[model samples]
Target: MSHVFPRHTRQAPPVAVAGDGCYLIDASGKRYLDGSGGAAVSCLGHSDSAIIEAIKTQVDSLAFAHTGFFTSEPAEKLADLLVANAPDGLDRVYLVSGGSEATEAAIKLARQYWVEKGRPEKGRLIARKQSYHGNTIGALSAGGNEWRRAQFGPLLLDVSHIAPCYEYRERAETETAEEYGLRAAQALEDEILRLGPDTVMAFMAEPVVGATAGALTPAPGYFKRIREICDKYDVLLILDEVMCGMGRTGSLFACEQDGIAPDIACIAKGLGAGYQPIGAMLCTAEIYAAIEAGSGFFQHGHTYIGHPTAAAAGHAVVSAILERGLVPRVREQGDKLAARLTERFGQHPHVGDLRGRGLFRGIELVADRDTKAPFDPARGVAGKIKKAAFEAGLICYPMSGTIDGKTGDHVLLAPPFIIEDAQIDELVDKLDTAIAAAV
Candidate 1:
């Protein structure tokens, strides 16, 4: 009798009634540890009184104000805070509803920047294969996950996908990690030349590949070379930090660790920390100045852009992260979690790789560790793990298609920044049980 549509048609999920710290409680009173932070969204956990009070205070005074007619205080303050802490050169913030909107706006802004510069021919977008940006049309187009794009192929834009900086499977035995990184980055330059440098506008990628490829961290100097190539070709580097930014990767911005900055950056998930629906697309001062000097308009907008209540919530979440010293805590707790995972799964026959930064981590499963071969797609290893974990009162993100878009599986763990040491052990224990049952 339920009319509400679900992501999967055949199964009905338990109704979540409440949240307590890092655990979610269903109507039946089962408490599930939020191991994946609900797709890496709840960085501050479910109940933070400071963020809750901020939302309440803002809503009592002012909730919504159309950005066209006015700019609210909360929105302005949040924007200022974000830019102040953002990567060097990124000075402007365009608030949106969620990750897809942030990335979609980034794409449009990139296109508009080129157009304003009188180079309308620079329209092609290049992204990495096995990357997931967002779900909207433009965001989806920029994303290279084949299975997600299979049915929507006709609706997607023509985007060229280069190989990802995946060190594990792609690196050759002959090359050192640094050598492999440089070789991987060369693909971007090669693709830009093949497509004609003048025809390419921007290159988009996640600093730590999530979802589609799990938390796939780039090798040393990988992003540095990417930054260099983009600079040399006059191509904009658009980093999608939707699921990995906002201190999720131990830095306010994930690219900071890579020692590079993007021409444009997209962030969400941890921004509002599941307290509100909010995302922001930040750009370099140069890009913002282009529109300011020319059209004085970005020619793109959403009705919910600059929503005050969401802004207030985001501001509080970020302030809590910075003021309460949670970023370093993420690094500290992340080390513990990583060590626990390695200790538990390092010798497991099916566990192929354990990788990621900060609280964001990934565990790739394989049929043969020696050959690094994936489990057969028909085995549904990821799906089974997810089900088993959930049944055991744990919530983790496990996805298929970690290799291409079909033949691999990985479990992504992104627990809250406030998680305790005992909780870390609990998370790994539950995950170990899940993997054992699944594989």
Candidate 2:
């Protein structure tokens, strides 16, 4: 029996002893290729000398200073770097220790912004079905996953959930992809109108729906329409990219690919590349000004809001990603990865779809490919696939409940930005074997 409480009480997982590039070696010396970057977190791979050195260097100088007292160089430099390349009008960074904390801060900040602007009634949050933001109570309340929220239902605050932009499942057979995109995007407007628009505070979603729905990407013009609705209603748009941002989706910010920017965005996972714990909530200049001019302060603070060593790791990671041109490489290799996956599984009897953007991709598995019918959840297909993948020495992010949080299964692949062509082949090969065995 282990004293450290593992995530799943019934099963104690393999002990990860070391990580070399995209592979993690367990205590037993089994090497598993990190095909999903540990749930799309590690973009620069597990071992990067520069990032490691940056963390050590910052720690040697300064580790932590209370945000209320002093500001650190690494934090200042990171904020500057992020704002310089952030989506349009986003001028400030509110750093946090992890994804859940970042989201909690974003939700509270959105409320505070409205309060400062004298729109205190705007407190309702709108999210989408099959979407995930984080696990904190606030973020959990904002999420739409039934399985996650069912037990905590009594504790979770009321929030609205609309249809997700899931083309393969939600799109009507006769509708064109673009029309389906438009129709899906229209849900927000309908929901807002039903709720009497002004009562709503923020509309939050993942640019590429991660974790909960197996890397579901929005259809063309979907986010464009979403932007229009949010603009018309004056509802703050919060893109929760904790699992999909920071160049995992080919661009520095996934919103860049969608061609629309959010009023506020939460980013983590790849920002520190696993070298340190760091997440950030970045916001538009107008939003920042609302609070700055009203109360002269944003009424939120965490002890580790801006730790120096973690900030140094984040700054170095972001700087290296842009300076070394890893973003373009992610895009290019992502195309090749998609092509290879399609070639391998596009026609498989159990494979229904291969979709996603950049290095982030998903392979939805089905019992019947023609109808795109999901395997019964009782079968536990996703869990079986994961076990098989691990047995085969491959680490892929596979999740069930791809549809309505219960029935569907998908395998998500988010390899490191530094992944090579040969590594892609190895990834696919292992996945192919795993899927075959699992089925």
Top candidate when judged by lDDT against the true structure: 1
Tell me the TM-score of each prediction against the true structure: 0.99, 0.99
Candidate 2 minimal-lDDT segment of 10 residues: 1-10
> After superposing candidate 1, which stretches have Cα over 4 Å from the reference?
none
Clashing pairs in 1: none
For residues 1-439, what per-residue lDDT tens digits would candidate 2 score against the true structure?
6899788898889899999998999999989999999878889988899999998888888989999999999999999999999999899999999999999999999999999999989999999989998898999998998988899999998999998999988888799999999999999999999999889999999999999888899999999999999999999999999988999988999999999999999999999998999999999999999988998899888899998889999999999999999999999999999999999998999999899999999999999998889998998998998999889988999999989988899999999999989999999999999999888
| Candidate 2: residue pairs that collide | none
lDDT of 1 by residue, 1-439 (tens): 8899899999999999999999999999999999999999999999899999999999999999999999999999999999999999999999999999999999999999999999999999999999998999999999999999999999999999999999999999999999999999999999999999999999999999989998999999999999999999999999999999999999999999999999999999999999999999999999999999999998999999999999999999999999999999999999999999999999899999999999999999999999999999999999999999999999999999999999999999999999999999999999999999999
lDDT of 2: 0.93
Give the range of the ten consecutive residues with the poorest summed lDDT in model 1. 1-10
Best by TM-score: 1
